[model samples]
Target: MRISALLIDDDPILRSGMKGLLSMVAPEVEIVAEAEDVQSGIAAIEKWKPQLIFLDIQLNDGTGFDVLEHFTQSTTRLESQVVFITAHEQYAVKAFRFSALDYLLKPVDPDDLRSVIEKVKKSQDDATGISHVELLLENIKRQTNSFKRIALTNSDGIHLFEIADIIRCESEDNYTTFYIRNNKPVLVSRTLKEFEELLRDHGFVRIHQSHLINLTFLKSYVKKNGGYVIMADQTHLPISQRNKERLQELITKTL
Candidate 1:
């Protein structure tokens, strides 16, 4: 399916470059509208109702957060998949990852942009984009503390879950299985490391290479034979020696 996308950035030169790159690498994504500031971006989104957006974190009048917040607070749901473009370093990129949002660095790498486009296409849950964006906006506003929702995508589709409901994640080679409350576990086509990167700061700990546990569901710590943890689900997972100290630290601070 051809994707109608909006470009929102303050720098005309960067926008021009990105447009050229998109035409070259992601021809399936057509630029439907362009805006240089928060107000114009919001207006473009309202008017065009594009399926995708290339948003700059910084704009002339206000930050991209302002634009997202406007859509989030609006009565009508915002129907768009956002891919943030920014020059900010580690912290901001971490923010996007934690929210499970796609983002590209400035001077937008062609391969990276292509990968992101492919991911968006594979998602196939366009109807839930608005809720995903809203969750992302909420996560950004609260940072690591308010990780209320998480998006998991697989062959079935994108599934959103309350952070508190997730018990733990078990690795299946390239895939990760998310164990949740009152629901069967979900197997997503992503690495345990990817989930670790996204969830580590949000009340999750990688106690072992194959396991990422939500501290909220931690039931007990077993201190025998390299140590292990008992989750609220009653499953026991080993704690790698490398991660043992850190896990203990987090456990002490958390509980």
Candidate 2:
């Protein structure tokens, strides 16, 4: 079967260029539709139901995680495989762990695209049409946003945190404290603002000046208590009344 694919990204140059790249490299793959943002992407996925999707981690409207939420929470099952295309270097390793069939870093090399396409095609051939999507979906959703890197410090020295074991980041007097999965919060040299700036590009958002929580690590939020968010590890963080509107906007825009 000719593999049908959808391309989603906000960069005009990259999006247009990528469509051309696919046409040249994987001639067998049909470009069925294109979406610049999450909602349209979701609509395209539902309409065309392509075999694969070339996705960008950031879109004008929201991040790739938002697009993913649509797929993960949808009633109509998604069977399309995903190929992540991104310019952000930090997210490469995270992409692989997220079970993306393939990834193309920005200013994509045609050769890389072709080689990965071949690999995916071979996997499809081996599967006799069945894919690992169902089995891997839960893990993908659970871990996609949980991967967080932290700069941990104590009386002795500095240490970089393991991404998977992170709990949350909280603003202190001048530093941002990292609360690990099971361990106590470790203060980092950089202020919470600095960390927020660093992570904002990677889907992290500030609910309150003192708290930068990963939406992917979210468990629940209280609407009545001036909106306090409860994370996956059951950590309660205050959401500033002023930022509540923007936070709600972000929450809606992502998923």
Candidate 3:
């Protein structure tokens, strides 16, 4: 399927570069229009109704977030898959990951751009994209360092879960199974190490190589033969010898 795309960036050179990259990597994507600022970007979006949007997070007049918020707060639903473009802002990158949104770092890499296009082609669900944007907007609106919700994509579909509701994550090779409160386990294709890094500051700790647990749902720690943690769901997960002291310190601080 041919994809119509709108490019919104303040920098002409970067826009030209993106156009060139898209042409070379994904000939199927056509640049319908281009805008250099928030208002112009919003106007182009309203006029063209493109299938995909390459949105720069920072613009002269306002940010790309302003453009998305305008449409989100209006009666029209944003149906295009949005790929956020930005310089390396650590917090912004984290927000995108938490919301399961696609992003490209500035001085965009061809491989990353191609990956985004491939994902857009595979999942053309407009609702999924809009929901991710909404989650992203909500996360940003909270004005907190910690993310309240996380979007997890499985073979079934993308599922949004409250971060606090996740009891634990069990890893099996490259797959991680999320055990949530009042929800069935969600099997995700990402490795445990990735999640550990993303969730470490949000009260999730890696007690073992295969286990990441939410401190909020931790019931107690038992130190019989070896250290183990009891989750609110009543699951017993072992704590590695190396992580036992760290877990104890965290538990002590929490108390």
Relative to the true structure, how large is the alpha-carbon lDDT of every model? Answer: 0.84, 0.70, 0.90
Which model scores highest in lDDT? 3
> Model 3: per-residue lDDT, tens digit, 103-154?
9998899999998898888877643356787888888776456688999987
Sort order, TM-score high to low: 3, 1, 2
Single out the weakest 10-residue window by summed lDDT for candidate 2: 126-135
Q: For candidate 2, lDDT tens digit of each residue in 1-255?
A: 588889998877887888788889888888889999988998998899888888887888987667777655668776777777877555443434333235788789999999878866855522211122332333344444554343343443435555555557887788767776767677754587766755664556788878887777877778976779999878788899888888888889878
TM-score of each model, paired residue for residue: 0.83, 0.50, 0.91
Off by over 4 Å in 2: 98-101, 125-255
Cα error of candidate 1 at position 35, Å:
1.2
Cα lDDT tens digits for candidate 1, 48-134: 988888899989998998998886678868777888999966767766765667899988999999999998897645543656666
- Please identify model 1 stretches exceeding 4 Å from their true place: 124-128, 145-148, 155-158, 223-227, 244-255
Residue 159 of candidate 3: its Cα lDDT? 95
- Candidate 1 at 220: error in angstroms? 4.1
* lDDT (Cα, 0-100) at 7 in candidate 3: 97
